[model samples]
Target: MIPIDFKGKRLVLFGAGRVARLMFSRFPELNVVAFADNDSAKHGTFVGKVPVVQPEALRHLEYDLVVISTGWWESITAQLQALGVAPSRIVLPPKNMLAINNGEKPFSHAPTKALALEVLGCVADFSARHAIPIMLDFGTLLGAVRDGDLIPWDDDIDFSLNDHAYPLFVNHLADLKVALPKPAGCDLDMTVLEAEDLITGVAVTYRNAVGCNAIVPFEIGFMRRVIENGQSVTKGAGPSFIAPEVHFHNVGSITFLGKQFCTPDDALGYLSYVYGDWKTPRQDVTLAEYPMQESEYLETSRTLV
Candidate 1:
Protein backbone atom coordinates (compact mmCIF):
# COMPACT_ATOMS: atom_id res chain seq x y z
CA MET A 1 0.00 0.00 0.00
CA ILE A 2 1.18 3.55 -0.75
CA PRO A 3 1.62 5.70 2.34
CA ILE A 4 0.66 9.37 2.23
CA ASP A 5 2.27 11.89 4.57
CA PHE A 6 -0.33 14.10 6.22
CA LYS A 7 2.00 15.92 8.61
CA GLY A 8 0.79 19.44 7.75
CA LYS A 9 -1.67 19.38 4.88
CA ARG A 10 -5.28 20.37 4.42
CA LEU A 11 -7.68 17.43 4.14
CA VAL A 12 -11.38 17.09 3.41
CA LEU A 13 -14.04 14.40 3.40
CA PHE A 14 -16.94 13.65 1.05
CA GLY A 15 -20.06 11.59 1.70
CA ALA A 16 -21.37 11.21 5.23
CA GLY A 17 -22.40 7.66 4.49
CA ARG A 18 -21.46 4.82 6.84
CA VAL A 19 -17.91 4.69 5.52
CA ALA A 20 -17.33 8.40 6.12
CA ARG A 21 -18.59 8.12 9.68
CA LEU A 22 -16.40 5.07 10.29
CA MET A 23 -13.27 6.74 8.92
CA PHE A 24 -13.83 9.95 10.89
CA SER A 25 -14.20 7.99 14.10
CA ARG A 26 -10.95 6.15 13.46
CA PHE A 27 -8.84 9.11 12.36
CA PRO A 28 -10.01 12.14 14.21
CA GLU A 29 -6.68 13.91 13.95
CA LEU A 30 -6.99 14.33 10.19
CA ASN A 31 -8.19 17.82 9.20
CA VAL A 32 -11.60 17.13 7.71
CA VAL A 33 -13.69 19.98 6.31
CA ALA A 34 -17.06 18.34 5.81
CA PHE A 35 -19.08 16.04 3.55
CA ALA A 36 -19.94 16.46 -0.13
CA ASP A 37 -22.39 14.13 -1.82
CA ASN A 38 -24.89 14.04 -4.71
CA ASP A 39 -27.93 12.95 -2.74
CA SER A 40 -30.19 15.98 -2.29
CA ALA A 41 -31.72 14.18 0.66
CA LYS A 42 -28.47 14.48 2.56
CA HIS A 43 -28.21 18.20 1.98
CA GLY A 44 -28.73 20.38 5.09
CA THR A 45 -27.91 17.31 7.21
CA PHE A 46 -24.75 17.05 9.27
CA VAL A 47 -22.47 14.21 10.08
CA GLY A 48 -21.32 14.93 13.62
CA LYS A 49 -21.83 18.65 12.83
CA VAL A 50 -19.68 18.53 9.69
CA PRO A 51 -22.26 19.75 7.23
CA VAL A 52 -23.38 17.56 4.31
CA VAL A 53 -23.12 20.07 1.51
CA GLN A 54 -23.79 19.69 -2.17
CA PRO A 55 -20.75 19.24 -4.47
CA GLU A 56 -21.13 22.63 -6.16
CA ALA A 57 -20.73 24.57 -2.91
CA LEU A 58 -17.24 23.21 -2.32
CA ARG A 59 -15.85 23.50 -5.89
CA HIS A 60 -13.50 26.32 -5.07
CA LEU A 61 -12.23 24.89 -1.79
CA GLU A 62 -8.72 23.49 -1.65
CA TYR A 63 -7.53 20.29 -0.04
CA ASP A 64 -4.38 18.19 0.00
CA LEU A 65 -6.30 15.04 0.68
CA VAL A 66 -9.88 14.14 -0.22
CA VAL A 67 -11.37 10.88 0.97
CA ILE A 68 -14.09 9.14 -1.00
CA SER A 69 -16.45 7.60 1.49
CA THR A 70 -19.15 6.39 -0.85
CA GLY A 71 -20.37 2.96 -2.06
CA TRP A 72 -20.88 3.74 -5.72
CA TRP A 73 -17.11 4.09 -5.79
CA GLU A 74 -16.44 3.74 -9.53
CA SER A 75 -19.17 6.13 -10.62
CA ILE A 76 -18.00 8.63 -8.03
CA THR A 77 -14.45 8.28 -9.32
CA ALA A 78 -15.59 8.99 -12.91
CA GLN A 79 -17.43 12.13 -11.84
CA LEU A 80 -14.42 13.25 -9.86
CA GLN A 81 -11.97 12.60 -12.73
CA ALA A 82 -14.15 14.59 -15.13
CA LEU A 83 -13.89 17.42 -12.60
CA GLY A 84 -10.04 17.08 -12.70
CA VAL A 85 -8.87 15.02 -9.70
CA ALA A 86 -5.40 13.51 -9.66
CA PRO A 87 -5.37 9.70 -9.71
CA SER A 88 -3.18 9.22 -6.63
CA ARG A 89 -5.64 10.96 -4.33
CA ILE A 90 -8.24 8.15 -4.29
CA VAL A 91 -8.22 4.69 -2.61
CA LEU A 92 -10.26 2.09 -0.80
CA PRO A 93 -9.43 -0.58 1.82
CA PRO A 94 -7.14 -3.36 0.56
CA LYS A 95 -8.44 -6.47 -1.17
CA ASN A 96 -8.35 -8.48 2.08
CA MET A 97 -10.96 -6.26 3.68
CA LEU A 98 -12.91 -6.09 0.45
CA ALA A 99 -13.06 -9.88 0.17
CA ILE A 100 -14.39 -10.41 3.68
CA ASN A 101 -17.08 -7.78 3.81
CA ASN A 102 -20.58 -9.15 3.13
CA GLY A 103 -23.09 -6.66 4.33
CA GLU A 104 -26.63 -5.78 3.28
CA LYS A 105 -25.16 -3.41 0.67
CA PRO A 106 -22.34 -4.51 -1.57
CA PHE A 107 -19.16 -2.58 -0.90
CA SER A 108 -17.43 -1.15 -3.97
CA HIS A 109 -13.73 -0.88 -3.25
CA ALA A 110 -12.54 0.18 -6.70
CA PRO A 111 -13.68 0.59 -10.30
CA THR A 112 -15.32 -2.57 -11.64
CA LYS A 113 -16.30 -3.68 -15.17
CA ALA A 114 -19.91 -3.16 -14.18
CA LEU A 115 -19.00 0.44 -13.45
CA ALA A 116 -16.91 0.75 -16.63
CA LEU A 117 -19.77 -0.33 -18.87
CA GLU A 118 -22.14 2.05 -17.13
CA VAL A 119 -19.75 4.99 -17.52
CA LEU A 120 -19.25 4.05 -21.17
CA GLY A 121 -22.98 4.02 -21.75
CA CYS A 122 -23.48 7.31 -19.95
CA VAL A 123 -20.72 9.10 -21.88
CA ALA A 124 -21.77 7.57 -25.19
CA ASP A 125 -25.40 8.55 -24.77
CA PHE A 126 -24.55 12.08 -23.72
CA SER A 127 -22.12 12.63 -26.58
CA ALA A 128 -24.45 11.20 -29.23
CA ARG A 129 -27.47 13.19 -28.11
CA HIS A 130 -25.46 16.39 -28.21
CA ALA A 131 -23.80 15.57 -31.57
CA ILE A 132 -20.44 15.05 -29.92
CA PRO A 133 -18.04 12.59 -31.56
CA ILE A 134 -15.83 10.26 -29.56
CA MET A 135 -13.20 7.67 -30.38
CA LEU A 136 -14.17 4.49 -28.57
CA ASP A 137 -11.00 3.36 -26.83
CA PHE A 138 -10.07 0.06 -25.16
CA GLY A 139 -7.00 -0.53 -22.98
CA THR A 140 -5.52 -3.22 -20.63
CA LEU A 141 -8.31 -5.67 -19.81
CA LEU A 142 -10.23 -3.48 -22.16
CA GLY A 143 -7.58 -4.36 -24.71
CA ALA A 144 -8.10 -8.03 -23.94
CA VAL A 145 -11.76 -7.51 -24.73
CA ARG A 146 -10.68 -6.36 -28.17
CA ASP A 147 -8.10 -9.15 -28.51
CA GLY A 148 -10.18 -11.93 -27.02
CA ASP A 149 -12.36 -12.38 -23.93
CA LEU A 150 -10.03 -12.10 -20.98
CA ILE A 151 -11.50 -10.17 -18.07
CA PRO A 152 -9.16 -7.54 -16.72
CA TRP A 153 -8.65 -7.16 -12.98
CA ASP A 154 -9.47 -3.46 -13.02
CA ASP A 155 -12.19 -1.27 -14.53
CA ASP A 156 -12.15 1.89 -16.70
CA ILE A 157 -13.34 3.17 -20.12
CA ASP A 158 -11.65 5.50 -22.61
CA PHE A 159 -12.95 8.27 -24.90
CA SER A 160 -10.68 11.01 -26.16
CA LEU A 161 -11.20 14.31 -28.04
CA ASN A 162 -8.39 16.38 -29.42
CA ASP A 163 -7.34 19.75 -27.95
CA HIS A 164 -9.94 21.87 -29.76
CA ALA A 165 -13.22 20.51 -28.36
CA TYR A 166 -12.67 20.55 -24.60
CA PRO A 167 -14.23 23.95 -23.87
CA LEU A 168 -17.65 23.09 -25.24
CA PHE A 169 -17.79 20.14 -22.85
CA VAL A 170 -17.47 22.52 -19.90
CA ASN A 171 -20.25 24.81 -21.14
CA HIS A 172 -22.56 21.85 -21.66
CA LEU A 173 -21.82 20.47 -18.20
CA ALA A 174 -22.28 23.85 -16.52
CA ASP A 175 -26.02 23.68 -17.17
CA LEU A 176 -26.57 20.04 -16.28
CA LYS A 177 -28.00 18.21 -13.28
CA VAL A 178 -24.79 16.22 -12.96
CA ALA A 179 -23.03 16.32 -9.59
CA LEU A 180 -19.26 15.86 -9.43
CA PRO A 181 -17.55 14.30 -6.44
CA LYS A 182 -14.95 16.39 -4.64
CA PRO A 183 -11.68 14.57 -4.00
CA ALA A 184 -8.00 15.49 -3.96
CA GLY A 185 -6.89 18.41 -6.06
CA CYS A 186 -10.54 19.26 -6.69
CA ASP A 187 -9.86 22.98 -6.78
CA LEU A 188 -6.88 22.47 -9.07
CA ASP A 189 -8.84 20.46 -11.62
CA MET A 190 -9.12 23.47 -13.84
CA THR A 191 -5.37 23.21 -14.39
CA VAL A 192 -5.28 19.69 -15.89
CA LEU A 193 -3.60 20.90 -19.06
CA GLU A 194 -0.78 22.47 -17.04
CA ALA A 195 -0.58 20.34 -13.88
CA GLU A 196 -0.04 17.00 -15.63
CA ASP A 197 1.31 15.75 -18.92
CA LEU A 198 -1.27 14.30 -21.29
CA ILE A 199 -0.15 10.72 -21.93
CA THR A 200 -1.52 8.65 -24.81
CA GLY A 201 -1.09 4.99 -25.67
CA VAL A 202 -0.54 3.98 -29.29
CA ALA A 203 -2.39 0.72 -28.59
CA VAL A 204 -4.19 1.17 -25.29
CA THR A 205 -7.57 2.51 -24.12
CA TYR A 206 -8.23 6.22 -23.52
CA ARG A 207 -9.25 5.74 -19.88
CA ASN A 208 -5.93 4.00 -19.35
CA ALA A 209 -4.37 7.48 -19.22
CA VAL A 210 -6.43 8.25 -16.10
CA GLY A 211 -6.92 4.90 -14.46
CA CYS A 212 -7.86 4.01 -10.87
CA ASN A 213 -6.97 6.45 -8.09
CA ALA A 214 -8.23 9.60 -6.42
CA ILE A 215 -8.88 12.72 -8.49
CA VAL A 216 -10.63 16.11 -8.17
CA PRO A 217 -13.53 17.77 -9.93
CA PHE A 218 -12.77 20.44 -12.57
CA GLU A 219 -15.18 23.10 -13.77
CA ILE A 220 -12.68 24.88 -16.01
CA GLY A 221 -13.83 22.51 -18.79
CA PHE A 222 -11.37 20.51 -20.93
CA MET A 223 -14.05 17.90 -21.69
CA ARG A 224 -16.48 20.46 -23.08
CA ARG A 225 -13.76 21.56 -25.49
CA VAL A 226 -13.43 17.97 -26.66
CA ILE A 227 -17.17 17.65 -27.30
CA GLU A 228 -17.41 20.89 -29.23
CA ASN A 229 -15.02 19.86 -32.01
CA GLY A 230 -16.31 16.29 -32.30
CA GLN A 231 -18.58 15.64 -35.28
CA SER A 232 -20.57 12.78 -36.87
CA VAL A 233 -19.94 11.58 -40.45
CA THR A 234 -21.17 8.74 -42.61
CA LYS A 235 -19.03 5.66 -43.35
CA GLY A 236 -19.49 3.93 -46.72
CA ALA A 237 -22.22 4.64 -49.26
CA GLY A 238 -25.84 3.52 -49.22
CA PRO A 239 -26.56 3.91 -45.50
CA SER A 240 -26.29 6.86 -43.18
CA PHE A 241 -23.64 6.98 -40.44
CA ILE A 242 -23.70 9.47 -37.60
CA ALA A 243 -20.28 8.90 -36.08
CA PRO A 244 -17.43 10.83 -37.64
CA GLU A 245 -13.95 9.92 -36.52
CA VAL A 246 -12.61 12.49 -34.05
CA HIS A 247 -9.42 14.13 -35.24
CA PHE A 248 -6.09 13.20 -33.60
CA HIS A 249 -2.46 13.50 -34.61
CA ASN A 250 -0.33 10.39 -34.63
CA VAL A 251 2.22 10.83 -31.83
CA GLY A 252 5.33 8.87 -32.80
CA SER A 253 7.00 7.92 -29.53
CA ILE A 254 6.12 8.71 -25.91
CA THR A 255 8.77 10.06 -23.56
CA PHE A 256 8.75 8.46 -20.12
CA LEU A 257 11.49 8.72 -17.46
CA GLY A 258 13.35 10.94 -19.93
CA LYS A 259 13.40 8.21 -22.57
CA GLN A 260 11.38 8.00 -25.78
CA PHE A 261 9.54 4.69 -26.21
CA CYS A 262 8.58 3.98 -29.83
CA THR A 263 5.33 2.32 -30.80
CA PRO A 264 4.85 -0.87 -32.36
CA ASP A 265 5.72 0.52 -28.84
CA ASP A 266 5.39 -2.97 -27.55
CA ALA A 267 4.92 -5.85 -30.02
CA LEU A 268 1.35 -4.55 -29.92
CA GLY A 269 2.80 -1.17 -30.82
CA TYR A 270 4.10 -2.80 -33.98
CA LEU A 271 0.63 -4.08 -34.79
CA SER A 272 -1.16 -0.85 -33.86
CA TYR A 273 1.22 1.35 -35.84
CA VAL A 274 0.98 -0.99 -38.79
CA TYR A 275 -2.80 -1.04 -38.59
CA GLY A 276 -3.10 2.62 -37.78
CA ASP A 277 -0.18 4.98 -38.50
CA TRP A 278 1.46 2.93 -41.24
CA LYS A 279 -1.94 2.19 -42.84
CA THR A 280 -1.14 -1.51 -43.27
CA PRO A 281 -3.78 -3.42 -41.32
CA ARG A 282 -2.93 -6.68 -39.60
CA GLN A 283 -5.80 -8.82 -38.38
CA ASP A 284 -5.42 -9.64 -34.59
CA VAL A 285 -1.77 -9.41 -33.51
CA THR A 286 -2.52 -11.16 -30.21
CA LEU A 287 -3.53 -14.28 -32.12
CA ALA A 288 0.06 -15.19 -33.04
CA GLU A 289 3.33 -14.51 -31.31
CA TYR A 290 6.95 -14.09 -32.24
CA PRO A 291 6.76 -16.55 -29.27
CA MET A 292 9.13 -15.03 -26.69
CA GLN A 293 7.09 -11.84 -27.21
CA GLU A 294 6.85 -11.30 -23.47
CA SER A 295 10.54 -12.03 -22.73
CA GLU A 296 12.20 -10.91 -25.96
CA TYR A 297 10.89 -7.40 -26.66
CA LEU A 298 8.65 -6.61 -23.70
CA GLU A 299 11.08 -7.92 -21.04
CA THR A 300 12.95 -4.63 -20.79
CA SER A 301 10.06 -2.23 -21.31
CA ARG A 302 9.92 0.12 -18.29
CA THR A 303 6.66 1.93 -18.78
CA LEU A 304 4.05 0.95 -16.13
CA VAL A 305 0.74 -0.15 -17.66
Candidate 2:
Protein backbone atom coordinates (compact mmCIF):
# COMPACT_ATOMS: atom_id res chain seq x y z
CA MET A 1 0.00 0.00 0.00
CA ILE A 2 2.92 2.33 0.65
CA PRO A 3 3.84 1.94 -3.07
CA ILE A 4 7.34 0.69 -2.36
CA ASP A 5 8.58 -2.85 -2.83
CA PHE A 6 9.93 -3.73 0.61
CA LYS A 7 11.53 -6.99 -0.40
CA GLY A 8 15.19 -6.97 0.71
CA LYS A 9 15.16 -3.19 1.18
CA ARG A 10 16.43 -1.55 4.39
CA LEU A 11 14.07 1.04 5.95
CA VAL A 12 14.57 3.85 8.47
CA LEU A 13 11.41 5.33 9.95
CA PHE A 14 11.69 9.04 10.79
CA GLY A 15 9.65 10.21 13.79
CA ALA A 16 9.04 7.87 16.73
CA GLY A 17 5.43 8.77 17.32
CA ARG A 18 2.25 6.67 17.06
CA VAL A 19 2.54 6.79 13.28
CA ALA A 20 5.95 5.17 13.39
CA ARG A 21 4.76 2.47 15.78
CA LEU A 22 1.76 1.77 13.58
CA MET A 23 3.88 1.47 10.45
CA PHE A 24 6.23 -0.92 12.21
CA SER A 25 3.35 -3.08 13.42
CA ARG A 26 1.44 -3.12 10.13
CA PHE A 27 4.41 -3.89 7.96
CA PRO A 28 6.11 -7.02 9.22
CA GLU A 29 8.00 -7.34 5.97
CA LEU A 30 9.78 -3.99 6.38
CA ASN A 31 13.44 -4.28 7.22
CA VAL A 32 13.28 -1.40 9.69
CA VAL A 33 16.86 -0.99 10.84
CA ALA A 34 16.42 2.13 13.00
CA PHE A 35 14.18 5.06 13.92
CA ALA A 36 15.28 8.69 13.51
CA ASP A 37 13.68 11.27 15.78
CA ASN A 38 14.27 14.96 16.52
CA ASP A 39 13.20 14.89 20.18
CA SER A 40 16.23 14.52 22.49
CA ALA A 41 14.24 12.40 24.96
CA LYS A 42 13.40 9.87 22.24
CA HIS A 43 16.98 9.67 20.95
CA GLY A 44 17.81 6.68 23.16
CA THR A 45 14.34 5.10 23.22
CA PHE A 46 13.17 2.10 21.27
CA VAL A 47 10.14 1.76 19.04
CA GLY A 48 9.09 -1.89 18.92
CA LYS A 49 12.63 -3.14 19.63
CA VAL A 50 14.13 -0.90 16.94
CA PRO A 51 16.51 1.61 18.46
CA VAL A 52 15.82 5.30 18.00
CA VAL A 53 18.68 7.57 16.94
CA GLN A 54 19.15 11.27 16.31
CA PRO A 55 18.57 12.63 12.81
CA GLU A 56 22.33 13.08 12.49
CA ALA A 57 22.74 9.31 12.72
CA LEU A 58 21.08 8.99 9.33
CA ARG A 59 24.23 10.33 7.64
CA HIS A 60 26.22 7.38 8.98
CA LEU A 61 23.52 4.71 8.64
CA GLU A 62 22.82 2.88 5.43
CA TYR A 63 19.18 2.40 4.42
CA ASP A 64 17.14 2.13 1.26
CA LEU A 65 14.17 4.27 2.33
CA VAL A 66 13.36 6.79 5.04
CA VAL A 67 9.63 6.81 5.77
CA ILE A 68 8.41 10.08 7.31
CA SER A 69 5.80 8.76 9.71
CA THR A 70 4.77 12.13 11.13
CA GLY A 71 2.03 14.38 9.77
CA TRP A 72 4.44 17.34 9.56
CA TRP A 73 5.88 16.02 6.35
CA GLU A 74 6.86 19.34 4.78
CA SER A 75 9.21 20.28 7.64
CA ILE A 76 10.52 16.75 7.96
CA THR A 77 11.15 16.56 4.24
CA ALA A 78 13.12 19.79 4.37
CA GLN A 79 15.12 18.48 7.32
CA LEU A 80 15.87 15.25 5.47
CA GLN A 81 16.87 17.14 2.36
CA ALA A 82 19.16 19.37 4.43
CA LEU A 83 20.73 16.24 5.86
CA GLY A 84 21.49 15.14 2.28
CA VAL A 85 18.89 12.36 2.21
CA ALA A 86 17.74 11.60 -1.30
CA PRO A 87 14.23 12.86 -2.05
CA SER A 88 13.62 9.61 -3.90
CA ARG A 89 14.12 7.61 -0.68
CA ILE A 90 11.79 9.64 1.52
CA VAL A 91 8.11 8.57 1.58
CA LEU A 92 5.08 10.19 3.17
CA PRO A 93 2.24 8.28 4.79
CA PRO A 94 -1.14 7.98 3.09
CA LYS A 95 -3.52 10.96 3.44
CA ASN A 96 -6.06 8.84 5.34
CA MET A 97 -3.50 7.87 7.94
CA LEU A 98 -2.45 11.46 8.48
CA ALA A 99 -6.03 12.81 8.68
CA ILE A 100 -7.38 10.03 10.88
CA ASN A 101 -4.55 9.62 13.39
CA ASN A 102 -1.84 12.22 12.84
CA GLY A 103 -3.69 15.33 14.10
CA GLU A 104 -4.21 16.70 10.59
CA LYS A 105 -7.37 18.81 10.37
CA PRO A 106 -9.97 18.57 7.63
CA PHE A 107 -10.53 21.28 5.02
CA SER A 108 -12.38 24.57 5.92
CA HIS A 109 -11.64 24.02 9.65
CA ALA A 110 -15.12 22.48 10.01
CA PRO A 111 -15.57 19.34 12.07
CA THR A 112 -14.92 16.56 9.55
CA LYS A 113 -17.53 14.06 10.65
CA ALA A 114 -20.26 16.57 11.47
CA LEU A 115 -19.95 18.56 8.22
CA ALA A 116 -19.83 15.38 6.12
CA LEU A 117 -22.93 13.98 7.80
CA GLU A 118 -24.82 17.26 7.38
CA VAL A 119 -24.06 17.41 3.66
CA LEU A 120 -24.94 13.74 3.15
CA GLY A 121 -28.20 14.20 5.04
CA CYS A 122 -29.20 17.09 2.79
CA VAL A 123 -28.52 15.05 -0.36
CA ALA A 124 -30.39 12.04 1.00
CA ASP A 125 -33.41 14.14 1.91
CA PHE A 126 -33.47 15.79 -1.50
CA SER A 127 -33.26 12.44 -3.30
CA ALA A 128 -36.10 10.99 -1.25
CA ARG A 129 -38.32 14.03 -1.76
CA HIS A 130 -37.76 14.07 -5.51
CA ALA A 131 -38.00 10.27 -5.86
CA ILE A 132 -34.65 10.36 -7.66
CA PRO A 133 -32.47 7.31 -7.24
CA ILE A 134 -28.89 8.08 -6.17
CA MET A 135 -26.08 5.99 -4.77
CA LEU A 136 -22.76 6.70 -3.10
CA ASP A 137 -19.84 6.52 -5.52
CA PHE A 138 -15.98 6.49 -5.52
CA GLY A 139 -14.18 7.50 -2.32
CA THR A 140 -17.43 8.44 -0.58
CA LEU A 141 -18.77 4.92 -0.98
CA LEU A 142 -15.45 3.38 0.06
CA GLY A 143 -15.23 5.55 3.16
CA ALA A 144 -18.83 4.80 4.17
CA VAL A 145 -18.47 1.02 3.95
CA ARG A 146 -14.86 0.75 5.10
CA ASP A 147 -14.47 3.58 7.64
CA GLY A 148 -18.15 4.19 8.44
CA ASP A 149 -17.67 7.92 7.70
CA LEU A 150 -16.25 10.36 5.20
CA ILE A 151 -12.50 10.05 4.72
CA PRO A 152 -11.13 12.98 6.66
CA TRP A 153 -8.69 13.96 3.92
CA ASP A 154 -11.33 13.82 1.19
CA ASP A 155 -12.32 17.32 0.02
CA ASP A 156 -15.82 16.41 -1.19
CA ILE A 157 -18.53 13.76 -1.28
CA ASP A 158 -19.35 11.72 -4.42
CA PHE A 159 -22.78 10.52 -5.50
CA SER A 160 -23.94 8.86 -8.73
CA LEU A 161 -27.21 9.22 -10.64
CA ASN A 162 -28.38 7.40 -13.74
CA ASP A 163 -28.99 9.36 -16.96
CA HIS A 164 -32.71 9.58 -16.18
CA ALA A 165 -32.29 10.85 -12.64
CA TYR A 166 -29.49 13.27 -13.60
CA PRO A 167 -31.65 15.51 -15.78
CA LEU A 168 -34.58 15.31 -13.38
CA PHE A 169 -32.37 16.31 -10.46
CA VAL A 170 -30.82 19.06 -12.57
CA ASN A 171 -34.29 20.41 -13.44
CA HIS A 172 -35.15 20.66 -9.74
CA LEU A 173 -31.92 22.44 -8.80
CA ALA A 174 -33.90 25.31 -7.28
CA ASP A 175 -35.69 22.92 -4.93
CA LEU A 176 -32.35 21.46 -3.81
CA LYS A 177 -30.98 24.93 -3.08
CA VAL A 178 -34.04 25.65 -0.97
CA ALA A 179 -33.57 22.37 0.86
CA LEU A 180 -29.95 23.17 1.74
CA PRO A 181 -29.87 24.52 5.28
CA LYS A 182 -28.14 27.79 6.14
CA PRO A 183 -27.07 27.18 9.72
CA ALA A 184 -26.77 30.30 11.87
CA GLY A 185 -23.46 32.12 11.25
CA CYS A 186 -22.85 30.24 8.00
CA ASP A 187 -23.46 30.93 4.29
CA LEU A 188 -24.37 28.05 1.95
CA ASP A 189 -24.50 28.13 -1.84
CA MET A 190 -24.88 25.75 -4.78
CA THR A 191 -24.13 26.04 -8.51
CA VAL A 192 -24.10 23.82 -11.57
CA LEU A 193 -21.27 23.93 -14.15
CA GLU A 194 -21.65 22.64 -17.70
CA ALA A 195 -19.00 20.89 -19.80
CA GLU A 196 -18.65 20.35 -23.53
CA ASP A 197 -20.67 17.13 -23.76
CA LEU A 198 -22.27 16.68 -20.33
CA ILE A 199 -24.09 18.70 -17.67
CA THR A 200 -22.22 18.60 -14.35
CA GLY A 201 -24.23 18.77 -11.14
CA VAL A 202 -24.12 21.45 -8.46
CA ALA A 203 -21.64 21.64 -5.58
CA VAL A 204 -22.93 22.51 -2.09
CA THR A 205 -20.52 24.79 -0.23
CA TYR A 206 -20.48 26.18 3.31
CA ARG A 207 -18.77 29.40 4.34
CA ASN A 208 -18.47 30.54 7.95
CA ALA A 209 -19.58 33.97 9.22
CA VAL A 210 -16.05 35.13 10.07
CA GLY A 211 -15.15 35.38 6.36
CA CYS A 212 -13.47 31.98 6.50
CA ASN A 213 -14.03 30.17 3.21
CA ALA A 214 -14.44 26.69 4.63
CA ILE A 215 -16.15 24.80 1.84
CA VAL A 216 -17.34 21.20 1.93
CA PRO A 217 -18.38 20.55 -1.67
CA PHE A 218 -20.43 17.56 -2.80
CA GLU A 219 -20.69 16.37 -6.45
CA ILE A 220 -23.21 14.17 -8.26
CA GLY A 221 -21.86 12.18 -11.21
CA PHE A 222 -24.15 11.37 -14.11
CA MET A 223 -23.79 7.76 -15.16
CA ARG A 224 -25.49 6.16 -18.17
CA ARG A 225 -25.88 2.54 -19.22
CA VAL A 226 -24.65 1.84 -22.74
CA ILE A 227 -23.51 -1.03 -24.91
CA GLU A 228 -19.78 -1.27 -25.62
CA ASN A 229 -18.72 -3.96 -28.06
CA GLY A 230 -21.96 -5.84 -27.51
CA GLN A 231 -21.57 -5.73 -23.69
CA SER A 232 -23.56 -3.53 -21.39
CA VAL A 233 -21.43 -1.07 -19.42
CA THR A 234 -21.87 2.03 -17.31
CA LYS A 235 -20.25 5.28 -18.43
CA GLY A 236 -19.94 8.59 -16.65
CA ALA A 237 -19.52 12.15 -17.92
CA GLY A 238 -16.03 13.11 -19.19
CA PRO A 239 -13.36 10.67 -20.33
CA SER A 240 -13.61 7.60 -18.10
CA PHE A 241 -13.47 3.87 -18.50
CA ILE A 242 -16.69 1.87 -18.71
CA ALA A 243 -17.70 -0.22 -15.71
CA PRO A 244 -19.80 -3.35 -15.53
CA GLU A 245 -23.47 -2.32 -15.79
CA VAL A 246 -24.45 -4.94 -13.22
CA HIS A 247 -22.78 -2.99 -10.42
CA PHE A 248 -25.16 -0.04 -10.85
CA HIS A 249 -28.44 -1.85 -11.56
CA ASN A 250 -29.79 -1.74 -7.99
CA VAL A 251 -29.26 0.24 -4.81
CA GLY A 252 -28.53 -0.84 -1.23
CA SER A 253 -28.21 1.00 2.04
CA ILE A 254 -25.24 1.33 4.39
CA THR A 255 -24.93 2.97 7.81
CA PHE A 256 -22.81 6.12 7.48
CA LEU A 257 -22.53 8.85 10.12
CA GLY A 258 -25.17 6.92 12.14
CA LYS A 259 -27.68 7.24 9.28
CA GLN A 260 -28.65 4.96 6.41
CA PHE A 261 -27.73 6.02 2.87
CA CYS A 262 -27.97 4.36 -0.51
CA THR A 263 -25.00 2.55 -2.05
CA PRO A 264 -24.50 0.23 -4.96
CA ASP A 265 -26.34 -3.07 -4.50
CA ASP A 266 -23.07 -5.01 -4.18
CA ALA A 267 -20.97 -2.44 -2.38
CA LEU A 268 -18.07 -4.75 -1.64
CA GLY A 269 -17.98 -6.14 -5.15
CA TYR A 270 -18.27 -2.70 -6.66
CA LEU A 271 -15.32 -1.44 -4.62
CA SER A 272 -13.25 -4.46 -5.49
CA TYR A 273 -13.87 -3.74 -9.16
CA VAL A 274 -12.89 -0.11 -8.86
CA TYR A 275 -10.19 -0.29 -6.20
CA GLY A 276 -8.16 -3.45 -6.27
CA ASP A 277 -7.54 -3.46 -2.51
CA TRP A 278 -10.37 -1.43 -1.04
CA LYS A 279 -9.34 -2.39 2.51
CA THR A 280 -6.03 -0.51 2.17
CA PRO A 281 -6.00 3.31 2.36
CA ARG A 282 -4.01 4.98 -0.42
CA GLN A 283 -3.16 8.61 -1.23
CA ASP A 284 -0.66 8.04 -4.00
CA VAL A 285 -3.31 7.51 -6.68
CA THR A 286 -6.97 8.23 -7.32
CA LEU A 287 -9.90 6.55 -9.08
CA ALA A 288 -9.10 8.47 -12.25
CA GLU A 289 -5.65 6.91 -12.42
CA TYR A 290 -6.90 3.34 -12.20
CA PRO A 291 -6.75 1.52 -15.54
CA MET A 292 -9.65 -0.46 -16.94
CA GLN A 293 -7.59 -3.65 -16.95
CA GLU A 294 -7.28 -3.51 -13.17
CA SER A 295 -11.02 -4.05 -12.79
CA GLU A 296 -13.48 -6.84 -13.69
CA TYR A 297 -14.89 -4.77 -16.55
CA LEU A 298 -13.91 -5.09 -20.18
CA GLU A 299 -10.16 -5.66 -20.29
CA THR A 300 -9.42 -5.75 -23.98
CA SER A 301 -10.15 -2.10 -24.62
CA ARG A 302 -8.85 0.91 -22.67
CA THR A 303 -10.95 3.31 -24.73
CA LEU A 304 -12.63 6.15 -22.85
CA VAL A 305 -16.41 5.97 -23.17
Question: Candidate 1, residues 1-305: lDDT per residue as tens digits?
Answer: 11245435565566666556765665556566767788799988887767777766656767776666544455666776676667676544321111111111111323333333333445445555665444333232123324332123222232344444444543455322142222332121111221123211111112212453332110111121122224322111111112222323332233322222221113344334223432332222221111111111111111222
Worst lDDT window (10 residues) for model 2?
A: 296-305
Model 2: per-residue Cα lDDT over 1-305, one tens digit each: 33455458888988887657876775667789999998899988898789999999999998998887754566678899999999998876553332222223343345644665776887788777888877788788988889877776665566776555678877787887787666666666565544434554445555565765443333333343344553334442323444566765676778766656777778898888788899999754433344332222121211111
**TM-score against native, each model:** 0.30, 0.53
Predictions in order: lDDT: 0.37, 0.65
In model 1, where do residues sit more than 4 Å from their true spots? Answer: 1-3, 93-305
State in Å the error of residue 26, model 2.
34
Q: What is every candidate's alpha-carbon RMSD to the true fold? A: 19.4, 13.7
User: Any idea what lDDT model 1 has?
Assistant: 0.37
Task: Tell me the lDDT of model 2 at 120.
Answer: 80
Error of 1 at 122 (Å): 48
